[model samples]
Target chain A: MSGPIDFYFDFASPYGYFAAGAIDALGARYQRTVNWHAIVLDANFQSLERIRIPSSVMRSDYIRRDVERVASFMKLPYKAPSSLGLHTELAARLFYWFNDRDPQQSRAFAQAVFKAYFVEDRNIAQLEVLQQLCCPLQMTPDDVASVAGDSATRARLKAEIDMAEARGVFGSPFFIVEGERFWGNDRLPLLERWLDAGTY
Target chain B: MSGPIDFYFDFASPYGYFAAGAIDALGARYQRTVNWHAIVLDANFQSLERIRIPSSVMRSDYIRRDVERVASFMKLPYKAPSSLGLHTELAARLFYWFNDRDPQQSRAFAQAVFKAYFVEDRNIAQLEVLQQLCCPLQMTPDDVASVAGDSATRARLKAEIDMAEARGVFGSPFFIVEGERFWGNDRLPLLERWLDAGTY
Candidate 1:
C-alpha cells in the first residue's frame, strides 16, 4: 500500500469495534499505516442540528441482522449491546489519549468497551464501570478523567469531528485513504486494494 | 441447499439489478431454488415513512465503487446505467408474466431490464427504449405492453408490493432465505454460505 488509512471510531458503536479487529488484520496484510481517530458521536450528532435519528423498529432490525452478518463473516462473537444510550464523550476523549500514547493499546481498549456493552450486556454509562474497564490499560483513573474533562482536549475533539463531517462522514468506522472516504467497514477490502494498486 | 432461496427485488433499484445476474449462479452453487419476487420500492417508502436518506455527494461515488466491487466479486462487467429511474411497475408486471409462462426467459428478461437501466443508462422510462431493449428476449412490444397494462396483473403487482411492506422490506435487493432478510447486494455471499450450511 502506498497510502495511510485513517479510521474514525467511537466506543459506543459495536460496529466500530468490529471494524477495529478486521482493520488490524488489514494493516498486517497490506503495506499501510493505520491512524485511529477517536470521535464523540453524540457531539457530532448535536453539531449536525441536534438531529437525533429517530430509532425505527425497521432500523433496529437491520442493525441486528447486520451485526450478525458481519460477525459471521469475521467469525467473531457478537450480541446486541445492552446499553442503548451512553454519553460517549469521556470514552472518546480517553481514546484520544490512548491514540497519542499507543495506537495498539487504543484498539484493545476499543474492543474491551465493545465487549463490555454488547457481549457482556453491561451498562457502560456508569463512570465506575468505565474506570474499572480502563484499569487493565495501566492508566490511572485520575489521569483519564482529567484528560477527558479538559476543555482544550474537548475542543480539539470537537474540531476533529467537524473536519470529519465536512469531509462527508455519515456513520461510524469511516475510513479515509488519500481523500477517498469509505463510509462502512465492509469497504475495507476495497480500500486495501485501491491502496495496493495506487489508484485514486 | 435443500429448499428455495427467496429473492426479494425492486425493479427501480440498481443494486437489485446487479444481484439478479448472479442470483441463479449462487442458487446453483448452493443447490437452492431462487424464487424471484417483484416488488415496488416506492410503496414500501410510503408505508414505512423512512427518512429520505440524504443524497450525499458520496451516494454516486459509493454506487460506482460498489458497481466495481460487485462486478469484480461476480466476474461481471458492472456499469452504472445512464437513465436512472424507470417506472418499475411495467418491468415488474412483465417479470410476473414471463415467470408464469417461462421461468428461464423471465430471468433473462429481468437481467435485460436491469442492464438497460443501470449499465446502458438508456431511458428505460420511455416505452420505445423498453421495446428496443425487450427485442432480444423474443418478446414483442405488444406482448410486453399488453401484460403490463392488464388491470388484473397491475392489481396483483400492487398486492405484491403491499405484501413486501407488510413483511418489513426497507430497501432494494433484499433476500429472504428461510425467513432471514438479507438487505443489500453485498450480503449475497453470506446469504449463499448460510444456505449451503443449512443455517436458515
Candidate 2:
C-alpha cells in the first residue's frame, strides 16, 4: 500500500527547512518518491481554530533557540532571520507554479528559497529578491512576476492548502504514506522505521 | 565536566512518561547519573505568559494520536487516561518527600506513578490511588497520607520548580548536562551524541 511519501511544509518554518534538507535523500535511500507540497500552514491552523504560537510570547524565545540548536544537530547552516512574521505566501504560490511544470526544478528552487531566508538573510517577501533567486532557473524577471498574482497559480495554491487541512495536517513537516500520518521533523526517525518494517 | 543529567518532568505529560522510560538507561550507558526532579510544568508556562496547548483545542486531536503512536514506538504499554488536566502537583510533592529519604526508592515510586496513570488508567491526582501505587515500595497508607500536604514537601516542590524555571526549564523532560539544555524526549538522541563527543 506504500506509494510516494507526501511531504507537507511551509516556507517560513525552520523545522520545515530541516525536513526539506534531508527528506529527499531519505526517500531516495528507501527507493521511494517524495511529493513536496508547500502550504500556508498558519492559515490552516486558523481554519481549524487552533492557536499559533505568537512571536511575542515566551515560547517564541525557546523556538528561536530550538531552531538554532536543531540546525546544528541536523548539520544545516542557519542564520536567524532578522525579521519575524515572514510573508511566505508569495513563495508558496511560486512553488506551485514551478511544481506544475517541473518537480525536479521545483525542489532546487525550494532549497534556494530556504537558504535565501535562513542562511543568506534575504527578505523573501520582497518581489525583487525572489525574482533574482529564480534567474538561475532560466526564468526572466517578467516570468516570475506573472506567477505572483496569476489567477491560475493562486487557485492552485488555495486548493493545495485546502486539501491539506481537510486531511488534518496542522503542523509543518507533516508526512503521510499509505494513510499513516506523522507530524514534525522529530517523527522522521520513526517514519523511517515504519518504511523499513511496515510497522514497528 | 559532564555531570549528572538533571531531568525535569511533570507526571501529567505523556512525553514525560516516554522520557522516564528510557533516560536512566541512556544515562547509565554513558556512565552518567540521572537526577530526577518532578515539576509542576504548567505553572512555569503560566509564569512565563506562554500558551500551553489546551487539551480541548484542535491541536489536541493530533496530540492524542501522537501520544498513542509514540507509546507504540517506545514499546511501552499505554491506555489513554480517562482524565485530562491531572492534578500532578500532589504527585510532584510526593516525589520529593520520598526523594529526601532514598533517591532509589523515589525513582521506583515515580515509575509506579507513571504506570498507574499511563498504562493502568488510574487517577494519580487522588490521594487514595497514589498511596496504593507506592505500596510496592513498602510505604504504608499512613506514611503516604503524611506527605499529601506536608508544608515541608510543598515548599520543597516549590523550590525545585522555581530553580528549574530560573534555569529556563519550561518543557517537560528537559535535560541539563554541563549546562547544555535539551528539551523534549525526541532530543535524547542529540543529547546522547553530545554525551559521546562533547559537541557536534
lDDT of each: 0.71, 0.84
The clash tally of candidate 2 reads 0
lDDT per residue as tens, model 1, A5-81 = 88887766767778877886686677678888777666655423222234452247666677777787877777776
The number of the candidate with the highest lDDT is 2
Model 2 residue B166 CA deviation in Å: 1.1
The residue-by-residue lDDT of candidate 1 on B1-200, one tens digit each, is: 37677787877676787788778888888777888888876553464546333323214555566566656655565566654455677778777777888888778877887777766777666667667767888889897677777997888777877777777676778888777778778777678778877662
* Poorest lDDT segment (10 consecutive residues) of candidate 2 chain A: A50-59
User: What DockQ does candidate 1 have relative to the true complex?
Assistant: 0.29
Candidate 2 lDDT over residue span A35-136, tens digit each = 999998655345463634454542366677777878999999999989865878888889888899999988988999999999999999888988998999
Best by DockQ: 2
* TM-score to native of every candidate shown: 0.89, 0.94
Q: TM-score for the second chain in candidate 1? A: 0.84
